[model samples]
Target: MNKLSCILLTLLAWLQYSLWLGKNGIYDFINIYNTTKLYENINDITQMRFRNNQLLYEIYDLLHGYEAVEERSRYNLGMIKIDETFYQIKL
Candidate 1:
């Protein structure tokens, strides 16, 4: 009876070890989950930085008055100075 009980206890310990530390175990799952979360956070921060840079560039352009306005008007509204002739060439 003692030998049988010892074997059962050893088997139980091995099962516990496999459950917590084996391939695709709880520990591995937790580690991979944490790594995924860290990468997602880094991606969010990078996107935010990109947006901030774009906004800063826009603010700089806005602060530069006429050049920015004229560029935007020419491209977006197709406006021209009164004395300048407009030309459109088709390819």
Candidate 2:
């Protein structure tokens, strides 16, 4: 009886050791984590919100005046007046 009990105790100890400190152990738990991805998503959301705010401001400016339209056309559409000369410089 004593020998059988000792063998069972040794087996139980080994299983507990593996469960606590071995591969797929509770201490590390590396494979199942997604906190980094969640943080990345949070950062992306903040950036998207900032971009949306900038777009909304631009929309408000465009709605209120023609100067915003002119500037947007000059820069985005590469437009110029009939008497104006367009210059390009590359560095």
Candidate 3:
């Protein structure tokens, strides 16, 4: 009886160890989850920076890019220079 009890206790301890610290354990899962979250945040930051750069470029263009401003005025505001003729053809 004593030997059987000792064997059972050892088996139980091994099972507990495997559950807590074996392959594919909770610690590994948590680490993977944290890494995924960190990467997601980094991706978000990269996207925001790209958008920010685009906005800054547009702002600079509006402030100093005469060609862009002229095109915008011609297309969006239907503006024409004093010496230019405006004609519209419909097909």
Q: When superposed on Cα atoms, how far off is each prediction in RMSD?
A: 5.1, 5.6, 5.5
- How many residue pairs clash in each candidate at the backbone level? 0, 0, 0
Q: What is the C-alpha local distance difference test score of candidate 3?
A: 0.90
The TM-score of predicted model 3 comes to 0.51
TM-score to native of every candidate shown: 0.52, 0.42, 0.51
Whole-model lDDT per candidate: 0.92, 0.88, 0.90
How should the candidates be ordered by lDDT, best one leading?
1, 3, 2
- TM-score winner, 1 or 3: 1
Q: Write the per-residue lDDT of candidate 3 for residues 1-91, one digit (tens) a residue.
A: 9999999999999888877787878777888899999999888988988999999999999998799899999899999899898899999
What is the alpha-carbon lDDT for the whole of candidate 1?
Answer: 0.92
Better of 2 and 3 by TM-score: 3
Query: Which pairs, if any, clash in model 1?
Result: none
Candidate 2 Cα misplacement greater than 4 A, ranges: 1-39, 76-91
